[model samples]
Target: MIAVGRIFRIQQELDCVALYFDRFESFSSTQVTSQVGLSYDSRISRLQWTDFAEAIPKLCCKTLADIPLIDDSAYVRELLQHAVMDDLLGPANGPNELIKDMSVRDRYLVGKLAPRETLDEGNDWGNSAVDEAEDVVPDDLEVKAKPAPPTAGKRTKGGEQPKDDEALGKGEPETSDEIDVSKNQSLVPSSFGITFCVDGEAERIEVEARWGRYERIHDHGITKTRKNKNKKTGKEEEIEVKVWQRIPCGGKMVLDLKQGPVSRRSPD
Candidate 1:
């Protein structure tokens, strides 16, 4: 019961939608009842497992009217009237625009979806962990250090950005009662705590990924040809070279367009 591609979930923590999944032992909750006993699990829409990382970017730009999952067009229009501006999902999203015919108060969502620090605190990772990984991480796979968090609050959507440890200092209440013990059981390093089956083994690679940031991450490996001493001929022979695909916490793993059928397998 492994979970796979393009799955959408309303990140109850940040109140934004997110695309989430990877191969791992299937873990699910039975209609999770919240503190007041209302179940929020049904807010998720699980598409069947398959790979389509390449097509996801376009989705971010589309409005609910453009990509209606439910048949109720009128309802979508209603949500749009009071919802966040178009392009909710995106690396390609444009500046936040106000929904038409709505007041300033009704134009955006009520709460912030993700924490301010998570967005403002760019991952300042170092390359020291590359060689230590099972796969040689490519230089391009590196995510740059994020600039400092915004100092002033803007009146745009998703509430205001955090003002340095304010959420923690104030002991802000958890947005929802959604709780999972599985996070504590993750074997991988970060909160992106899942592993995959490649070449018949669980690749327990450590990654420094941010939760709730949905985007395409292209994985690469060191697949270069280098000269090596041929003990028999004592000559450098041009040999075919293959390398592992790096798993950066930064992106999703669709079957690499560079790879083919059976190029890898999901955990069984």
Candidate 2:
């Protein structure tokens, strides 16, 4: 009975310590304050660590946007540290909700907790799935972007010019440098225009090639890439999708298609 009682008391003490630390963190940092009288009346802001304990509760449920106007107080820093630890521990009062509710600036500090190696190529190291796809990145490096179709300014109305609005407005205005060029293109029939293997397994698909810059006016539109294979010879070929051809992140793309029969090679 005594041992159980002692354990309860220790737990209570620990809880109290945590609470005190949470509250103390808010006032621990240096703050900017308005300076008093000069020979000529002028307002100057001086930095000091002031009454943080009193000021902290005001930010109890506030976001990073709600940080005191003066900014970067020791108390706030400590509070943020405690909040991060709490988040990692999945604690109830370590400001996890408040941190989540914070503005972009505060969220940046949280994001910093992630290691540099994990964020090397905008890779999300925080997720376990990315860690598993270690081999995908290498294969991605081999693929290159497909060349854009002739631009609108370059298009002249003559011999083999496009006959329709849809044909005339093929590729969109997105920067080609920003786009991901695909490897393995296929050309096929109207019903099944192309054929290519994502993981080496054949996908009988269709491709759409476009001329100049085209843009999608709204969301939820479908853009198709076509490819085809000779059934008898099994010689596979794919025509490029001229409008917007981008190879997705190899790791993420492969993971997304893991349930499918073919697993895509890692991309650069």
Candidate 3:
């Protein structure tokens, strides 16, 4: 009797969630693992950690319009993080439904991974932003506007501003020299980009990194016991329980030796 009573007492203090019907609960990160979910994107197959880097090339791909840049690391991270099915919001205090309800499994898998990388080129661009900016500082360390080419008379030495130099534009403080120039760029913009692409393995590694023993996302969710109607007992009682849930998943895991945490050498 003492041992049984002690067990109950201990459980009463630990966190647990009430599994109520009709409540769309957030997926239990504690219950989830890398062993479940979908991978390979076979449209029929699912994995806990999908290897999109390996899968995209097998499918026919096409480029639509090109963005001047993917922006930067934060932008890419945002694009990956928010690529989910839906919010499926409920009453303010109620559970969120869209979180785990992957009606469209394919979208869910790809959206979960965004299946992209931390490219060497992008990293170089980011580093170069800092490096190149140093070189662009004026000889005296202040960027004073060079007087506009002598108001369009016969072109004078150093006064012939190119049509593309927006520094000549009224009220513009930055000059073209201060901006980054892409190798193949024909047209220049006022701002620059510092970003690179990475490989699939790096991304996958990032997803599997521990938020905790079994928890992912923000933090571990521990619940306090609460009084509720017990279906089995048909009476009001205090109940508390912790649950870990995971769906089974499968995919071929490969490694990109040239990139990610496993790389032996980086591109020169």
For each candidate in turn, the TM-score is: 0.14, 0.19, 0.14
> After superposition, which runs of candidate 2 have C-alpha atoms over 4 Å from their true positions?
1-17, 21-73, 84-150, 153-160, 163-169, 172-268
> Residue 109: error of model 3 in Å?
5.2
When 1 and 2 are scored with lDDT, the better candidate is 1
TM-score of 2: 0.19
The lDDT values for all models are 0.32, 0.31, 0.30
Cα lDDT tens digits, model 1, 1-268, are: 2122322332222235443322112223332223213323465644322323322223243322333344456745654543343223321122222122222222222221221122124524322222222232223333344344444544336685554544324433334232221222232223223555555453334323322221222342223344677889887665533322222233334443333453533321
Clashes of 2: 35
Best by TM-score: 2
The full ranking of all candidates by lDDT, starting with the best, is 1, 2, 3
The better candidate by lDDT, 1 or 3, is: 1
Q: 119-146 in candidate 3: lDDT tens per residue? A: 3555332322222333222234344565
Better of 1 and 2 by TM-score: 2
Worst 10 residues of 3 by lDDT: 1-10
Top-lDDT structure, candidate number: 1
